[model samples]
Target: MTEPTGLGMSKVARILMVEDDEDDYILTSDSLEQLDSYQFDIHWVTNPKVAVEKLSQEEFDICLLDFQLGAQSGLDVLRQAIKLGCMTPIIMLTGQDDDNLDKLAQDAGAVDYINKEDISTGRFARAIRYALARNEVASERLERLKAETQNRSKDRFLAHLSHELRTPLTSILGYTELLLQGEKAKESRSELNIILSNGKHLLSLLNDVLDLSKIAADKLELNPSEINLDSFIADVFYLLQINAQDKGLSLVITAPQALPERIRADSTRLRQILINLSYNAIKFTDHGQVAIKLWTEWVEQKELLFFEVADTGIGIPAERLASIFKPFEQVEDIVTRKEGGAGLGLAICTELARRMGGELSVESELGKGSRFRFAIEPGDISDVPRSELHFVKADTNQDNEHYDPLQGRVLVVDDAPDIRQLVQKICDGFGLQVVTAENGLQAVQMCNESLSLDTPFTLVLMDIHMPVLGGRQAIAQIREAGFTAPVIALTAAALKGVKRSLVDIGFSDVLHKPINKKALYQCMSMHLAAQESGEQIDEVEPHILLVEDDVDAAEVSKMLLESLGAKVTLAFTGAECLAVLQSSLPVCKILLDLHLPDTDGLSLAAQIRTISPELEIVVVSGAQIEASQLSALNISRSLLKPLNLSTLQSLID
Candidate 1:
């Protein structure tokens, strides 16, 4: 053949021959001899023991093992060689015809199984070439998996460090601000302000790094909902207008007439992107306006939401524009010198845009202005025409911080002493009496103890993570204990989508840690005002236990009961039903099916009453039920299957 073939590689190919018969070794050598592109060095060993010793050294690239060996088979040598850290590729050879031997040979770590009768020049050469190619691919895959695992470990370490850093920063910033509020030591006020400002900047940077870590680890999730564009855009402008106005810069909002009025997106993430970009524009501009405009682009048949933040501030130079969006990379110019930043805003915004099925790009002219554009495929869009809107500056705050103090009692739960005292001081300013608990278990006990005295907390501020008991479980127990006051979660966990999780776990509202007094005050005021006006959460649904052997029938009955506003638990056997009762859960009634798999339904009723005498038991079945039998067991009622909605409704009532 021409230059070379696969078996005739450029380098010398080392082959190990493990054969008891000398004739087979010669035939194997002759077949490989057909390819002459490179030299082939074959090491022959007639003893299986000697073959294993040579193979263990890994000095050969490939091994050819014959199935027929004296006393011991070649498969044993192959397996032993593999067990001793051998990486050499192996091909099993047999002299006789046997169908099952091929599978057995391959199963014992041989790369291929070949018959000596089929040892043609081309076939034998191709078999050796395929084995080597496969080994190379497998080695490459192992390295890739190792790299990915290391990356994940690094991400986790970064996240833990960020969280640990925030805990101490919270107390430092909280106390500094509190001291400044009282006009304590007029001469030291400026120095205290400096500490507060720098602490906040550091906190902001920590948040940025943590967010990127979460995104990189694929831990960040998005929850999109329909939003009214008019209010959403107006709110963004209103929030930033004050910051812009303070610096003599204008915040402008504009939209093209063709833009849709409503779209589906995660409002929190969208707001974060808009705020970061617009705030940067404000911070950079000395005395010009930051304009945010919205439009749409048609890609194929789908419409994409296109928005731009154009600022008439100091523009980026041509050479630095390429690296401006890179994380931790800032365009080092006069403007950047005056307004220092972590340089993570644009990088984070770009990543979040991609997660929403879009991209972010920018254009700028030196000493003129910069324009940042973002386009996203909004999950859903409406055809309604958008109303024209313009930005107006938000009103400034008054100097004095005074309020009509609320008259009520509040319980604050936290593991940290500093946080507990800080919250107590804030609540004192509101004129609300305060109670504190170091952990969730203690908080539940305090609430129960207070209830016995005819005095209970008007509101609860609970921390999410704690020792002994967690906030979620504590709140559940609080609810079980008949405490219906509004419970607000105080958390330091700032991961995206955490607020939704807290709310679903029965929290009325979520307040992030390194707490802002303004936000906390507003949340407390809103919740307390609602409580004062007799507006409370709806009554708890009555719990019912339904025991049925048929899974389909049990599910149907559970659904029907839930439709009538009752919480139903279904058990397919008497044992499961008994376990449920033993938990001491508040059950209003028990629905029993007369047909049984383990024991009679009526017999199970006797055990149910022993756990709770007040829990009424109702028997359900076809014409197999009789009223006289149910009355004998002190069972409440007897009803037929394919339940009547009215009868089920009466049971819960």
Candidate 2:
């Protein structure tokens, strides 16, 4: 048999020939040496025992075994090699009439079985080359799979650890806020502030870790809404003002005076993307200004809103700009080690921009600074009545003192005793009449009794999942009974389904579990205004109709939504969707899965629009939906699975 060239040029591939006959062994070796490109060094063994011994001592690239080797068959040697994890490819040579031996050789781990009478130089060489190439490809695939599994395990562990850390961190922040507000000792006050600040910083790090995990898993979601460009930029400036001030840098924002007030985008994600870019800009710029410029351009009938964050800092080298966006990659190795970051900010921003149907690019010079620009298509901006913009701004104190609304009744319901006590203490500290319930049933009973006494509950803090009668069920019953109090679902379950179910079950609002003190106060203050107005609050929970064809996944997701208190109607196909729309349940939002066996998601969304053009539709797909398709469908939001609970909550909120 002829050996192939290029196969053994580097470290010559060793081959073991196991044959009992001396004549056959010499002939095989002569044939291999005579080939034009044959470079392998052949080791001839007269017995199977000697061949096995050589295999144990040497690493051969390929093995050629004769079917007949005295009493010891080639099959025996092949089995022994396989048992020892010998991955070398083996080719078995057999007599033309020895069909049984050829079959047995293959069953024992020989890669290929060839007949000696039929073997030619061309066929023999081609077979060897094919075997080696196949082995290499298999090895590569195995290595890749191993690496992927390791990464996934690490991600899962981090996610679980972060979740555990959040629980106590929430309590620490809660107690610290109380101490900071109450009449604590002066010395203790300063220490509490330090504690609060450190806690907040740690919380931010934890959030970053969670966000990174979500991005890696492709579970990060965007909740796009129409945002006023001027107002949005103003808010961003307000948020970054402190950072810029600390660095003694000038930060400027410039936009057209009459620029479109509304652009369709995910506000939180947009804020995150901008914050990362702006902070980097400010961090690097020690002496110069960091300017953010916004403009709108119409390119080929698409309205692209462009933003540029230009900083006059120590800029990146021209050659390193491309590599800067890679995860854990920075301009220089020392820059990352000194600057203290996972070097993932830019990478995350780039990915977020891509998900928002835009591209993020940068231009910089070594001595000057860098300019990072990204653009997203402008969303539909309908005229909002002037009256809706009239919101009362809370008074700010020079001392950053907490504002406590006096003598209000507050109800707190939660499964965790620590969380219940925490809420009660905060409310009592505010001088409010606080009532506590361990579960939803007690909460409902208290609400009913308060109504009878003509001192109806001012507000109800209901936990989503309780021992008897969950938050959603209790809220629905209370609302059905004409109780006008604002019921907020306080839940620790951050899953999308849980939040959606809470909203669906007719709660006034949802505050994610492990509640933030500031967020709780804000909710209370807003609801109190509604209570004073004496307006009969309508139980108008947003309706989200999920259209998906995968039965098992759909059922599980539906249950999750129900847990979140969302009234969900599932349609397995486009035909089902059309039928549902015909029946007349007004849907506030629709979650459309793109790939369906019966009909496509995009087509279903279009059909829904034909019925109710104003219906909010969120496209759900396993694959990334292109910008072109989103524009064509007029889809405001797109969620990729496994879906993020926070993104879904933001959309409904």
Candidate 3:
């Protein structure tokens, strides 16, 4: 509703003077005429009503109004001009120099206030130019703020959508895992695999969408940690190798002979980026090869870790490359439709790379191939051996020893019957007894009863979310009832910080769902051997403490110790073992796993020696430490994993 611009007038000063006094109007005209820089064309209105009408009809560079009119004041004319919706700048001309009147005149939309005696052409021109520039700046700022607010609203909606999608996806993946493991009918294996695969694919897509929303809103953050890049990439590649084999494509990994053992990066997100690009390459390529190469290069005085994933099947058209990195955009073709994605992978990768202080780019040609390359700033190197070099493939049948020496019951609590049955079946396969509970409340009552009967459960597997008395609350109540058994949290919520939160909520450990049978067995074995039995015995059996962080290694050692007629108590980390010893647990010897997650074995042994001077400490590790080193730590014996049972028995005797 404001005035458009200057009216159809020549290059001259156009002024509207709203004053009823004849002398004041003549004085203003004569004052303007004294300025020879520009010609003056003045329009005089005698009343406030006529001033408003002229403001609506004609455009003027500025308006000058006398403070006192015949029956109305200059403030009245100022308000009328503003009400008529003309943006023409106004300067109030007053006979008396009063501060209050000047304030009132500006507040009513006058650009500036001037006394009639002080008015000059130069002062009027400056006020008009300043007002126009200030209004334009304010308008631009308001528009920008509005756009930012709308974008934030959209990001919040996307985050909410992610949470809603994950809740159901959890159930889908968990049940599929149960069926895949427990269903003995070979005919159903392929079908179960398909269900599991598609569910995981859906999860990946949902995560990509949420990631894009985060990057767009500048909310994505990095959590950097030391990572063994060689071992990590091998593991990521091994996962997708089967898909390549199925598609009749060769999968290749090329790396330098001696890459740095460790680099600083957000391992999870780094792995995610690689996996997404690798999956996309394999999905689009048919009867071709996928190559992943890793190397390091110096860029701008900083070492950049470079990764490239290339394929040999189909390549993008030249015109489509730019748009492919845009959200929800893809090459329109039958192949794209058949692949079936929302086209968020490359867009997310580009943003993630940028956030990591790097860039992602591509090179491709139609019907030839495409290569995606990315690099990021590499941080300090570690002296520890590369994980691939130190890694030893575990013996799957290491627990084939038919000792079954330890006798205790486990409590399996889950609302899903399929999960409970599947876990029970696995426990049964390993020759352990299990009791089932449909919810956390039922599990708590069972635990309390078992303790009162002097037959405490060895382990509790509690699901995190359920209908009645959720897992966290149930654990708190159990702890209050003085039950001290290790409770593992079995959760479908695998988001970041979930594991830390579960531990803080008093869970001994966490296991993400769509369970791996081997991992489940390792978790149960580790916790089940966590403490010695409270039962009294006639003859004192050697109560040995086994402290090891790796569950498979701990399980193997537990079987060996039990076979040697020693009751074993397992602790997964240095802190847990120290906590156990502080509780005055009866111990004759300690079989300590030196590679503890929280502390090194030698350091832990020294600490243990200081606290328990009479206790015998033995170092157990997958790593090779020298005999002299063990002596320096004041340790008598050291045992290597893939343990020698005969040697262990002789030492125990």
Which numbered prediction scores highest in TM-score against the true structure? Answer: 2
Q: Which tens-of-lDDT digit does each residue in 100-136 have in candidate 1?
A: 8988887888988888988875677789778655655
TM-score, structure 2 vs. true: 0.57
Report backbone clashes per prediction. 0, 14, 0
Q: What's the residue-level lDDT of 522 in candidate 1?
A: 86
Give TM per candidate: 0.55, 0.57, 0.51
Worst 10 residues of 2 by lDDT: 389-398
- Sort every candidate by lDDT, greatest first: 1, 3, 2
Per-model root-mean-square deviation over C-alphas: 12.4, 13.2, 20.6
Name the runs in model 1 displaced over 4 angstroms: 1-115, 118-155, 176-193, 214-323, 326-329, 333-343, 351-361, 366-410, 428-432, 440-460, 467-489, 497-510, 516-653
> Model-by-model lDDT, in order?
0.78, 0.73, 0.75
TM-score, prediction 3: 0.51
The candidate scoring highest on lDDT is 1
Better of 2 and 3 by TM-score: 2
Per residue, candidate 2 scores C-alpha lDDT tens digits across 337-396 of 446666777888888888887889999987798899997766754343211221222321
